[model samples]
Target: MDLETLLSFEWGIMMPEFIILGVATVMTLLDLFMPKGLKRKILGWIGFAGILAAIVSLIGLLDYPVTTILFDTFRLDSFAKAFKLILLVGAALVMLLAISYEPKEGLTEYRSEFFYLFLTALLGAMIVTSSGDLITLYVGLELLSLSSYILAGLRKENRRSNEAAMKYVVNGSISTAITLFGVSYVYGLTGTTNIAAMREILLALNDSQSVYLLVISFLMIFVGLSFKIAAAPFHMWAPDVYEGAPTPVTAFLSVVSKIAGFVLLVRVMLSIFANAVTDGPNSTSILLTMEDTIAFIAGVTMVVGNVVALQQKNMKRLFAYSSIAHAGYILVAIASLSLFMFDSLWFYLIAYLFMNLGAFAIIQTLTEKSDSEDSSHFSGLYTRAPILAVAMAVMILSLAGIPGTAGFIGKLNIITGALVREQANYVLVSVMIATTVISYVFYFGIMVQMFFRKAKVKDPIKIPVGTGIVIGVCAVATVLLGIFPNIAFDFLQAQFYEFGDFLR
Candidate 1:
């Protein structure tokens, strides 16, 4: 912690995190001093620019050597660079949507607060992405979780919003406790908070009882982090939270927040648990022994999310369940541990970013127009706003994993990776396929409401320029990535190159 030690470490590699922290601080000051009469949406523009700068800064650091700072509390490597890129890009888009968002009440008075809160949350996610120490990881996790609790209840005037906020905070607190309990066990076992060091110590241990303790810690951590990802048995909070939160915040949760959970998963599971010696017959590592358990969780999550979604009439709840199912698909990649695991996980998250955000933007536009969250609002949308309806169809189809879309390509890679593995996960793969088909019933139901149902209102819904831009960009990207997935895969391989230094 000495100045000499700090000065010796290259600070240039941390520019991305520094930029985000600085932006959040600066915007908080602006929100305080700026005149009440002036437009505050300018904060959104600043946030967007700041996030783009972070992206550029991160790209510059991809060539920098992987290094840890401040007693290994912070680290820079290919894993951080690649995932931080997604976080920044996704935040930038969500910022635009936030600028365009027009909530019914209360939020207008606190418009500027919204922008800085989001940046702070993004900062937390970035911290988790780079953290090498368990304490640093927990701090970042709470930063994101606590900020999300506030964002979920931004509408002071709405009853449902308040209820959603209460539920979110309670569930979040429980999850945090569970995660810390696991971390404490890890510290007791290895006498260190640094994960890389723990890995070295864990590999040397041959005690079966100690390995069982590690497995218990793994389950505790998995159950806790599952709430972050909206995975099943812990996903009940999502439907209510997503239903009540503002549209832009919902998009942030579905894409950016969800991706950050997976980041933590890879960090904790792979770094500390994946390589831990099981010292059992034919089992080289704890992760190998736990694959079947992971697959079971994945299967149940996919089933619960897709099956429950079939009955949801509210748009946000439906998408919440959809997000859960998507998480299950990515978990399949994690469980199978195929050579293509990184490719499948990273690419699916990218595709999910575009596909989910685009759909939410459109949903926001429509629901705000009709003052409803019911599926019926989409009825006769094609006749009222043909272009908007068509774009929505594309997003929904992508979510359903239909061919000729990014979702399809993302799903294909996961299945291919699963089947091509040393021991194919045919059972989990079957679950993925079956649940995806079940999802189609509701996905196409929305399409039917758009194209086949009669219009409830006669006036054509006008789209704002900001929302229009989001829809257009996401739609085109979804299609292009589907046909030319190599564009993403190539950039991914260039930046991460198989995530070798990731677990280190």
Candidate 2:
């Protein structure tokens, strides 16, 4: 802890995190001093610029050697670099959405706080990606969770918003407790909190008792963290939260928050359990031993998500279920434990970002138009706003996994990865295909409302500059990535190869 020793450690690898922290702090101070009458939307613009800077900083660190600092609690590796890029880009888009949002009740009073809270949440996600120790990961998770809880309830006068916040806090606290209890078991068994050191210890242990302890701990951790990703049995809070939160916050949670959860899940499961062996006569890695269990959950998640979505009249609630189903799809890739697991997961996440956010942008516009989020809001959308209507169609098609869209390509990659495994996950893959078909019924229901129904009002929807930018970027990315998927795949493969033995 001496100054000289601390100074000797390489800190340059932390530039992105430092930039996010600086931005959040500066925005908080600005919010405190700014005149009450001044437009708070400018803070969102500044936050967006800060995210751009952080993205640039991250790009610069890609060439640096993988390094851990602060007594091995933080590490910069390929996984962290790649995932952090997603977090930054995703946050920037959400910031734009925040800037454009103009609710009927007017969120002007709390706009500045919303902007900075997003930065804090982004910082938390970045921290989770780079963390190399269990304690650091837990801190990052709570930081993100706490900020999100407040964000969900930002509409001060809305009873639904307040209720959403309450549910989130209660569920989040329980999940945190469960995760910590699991971590305690791990620390007790391995006598270390560092992921790498624990891996070595778990690999060396061969006793049946140790194996049983590891299994119990893994179950505890997985169940708790599943709440973060909105995986089934733990997904009850998502629809209500999504419907109640501000549109921008909903988009942020669906994309950035979900990505962070997956990053943490992949990090913990692969780092701690990848080398731990089972207790049977024909011993296997803990991940492989638990594959069936994970697959079962994945199957149920997809079925419940899609089937329940069929009954939803509210747009936000429908998308909430859709998000849950997508999580299940990605989990199949994780369960397969394929060599290209990260590749499949990353590509799908990127696709999800563009398609889902684009859909939300349109949803926000439509819902605000009529002050209702019902399916009727989309009726005769094509006649009222043809261009925006087309954009909505593209996003909906992509979500339904139609060919010539990013979601389709992403699903193809995931299915291919699963089938290529030595022991193919036929059951999980079959379930995914069936559920996807079921999903189309609800997805197309919106389409039918858009194209065939009559509008309650004849006025065209006006798209703001910020909102237009998001929709344009997302639509373009979706089509381009679909047509030439190899662009992203090539980059992912190169990075994976460069990283050399992930989670070792």
Number of the top candidate by lDDT? 2
- Residues 1-504, candidate 1: write the lDDT tens digits: 687887997788789888989998999899889998889988888988998898888888887778888877898988888888889888988998898888666466888888988998998999999999998998999899889999988888888889889999999999889988888878899999998889899988758888889888888998899988988989989999999888899999999999999999988898998778777566578888888988988999999999999999999999999999999999999998888888888899999999999999999988864345999989999999988998999899899999999999999999999999888989999999999999999999999999999998887677877788899999999999988999998888776764868676
**Runs off by more than 4 Å, candidate 1:** 280-283, 369-371
TM-score of 2: 0.98
Candidate 2 lDDT over 68-146, as tens digits, reads: 8998899988899989999998999899999999888888789898999999999999999999999999899989999
Candidate 1: pairs in clash: none
lDDT scores in order: 0.89, 0.90
Q: What's the residue-level lDDT of 215 in candidate 2? A: 92
CA displacement after TM-score superposition, residue 225 of candidate 1 (Å): 0.5
Candidate 1: lDDT over CA atoms?
0.89
Q: What is the C-alpha RMSD of each candidate to the true structure, in Å?
A: 1.2, 1.1
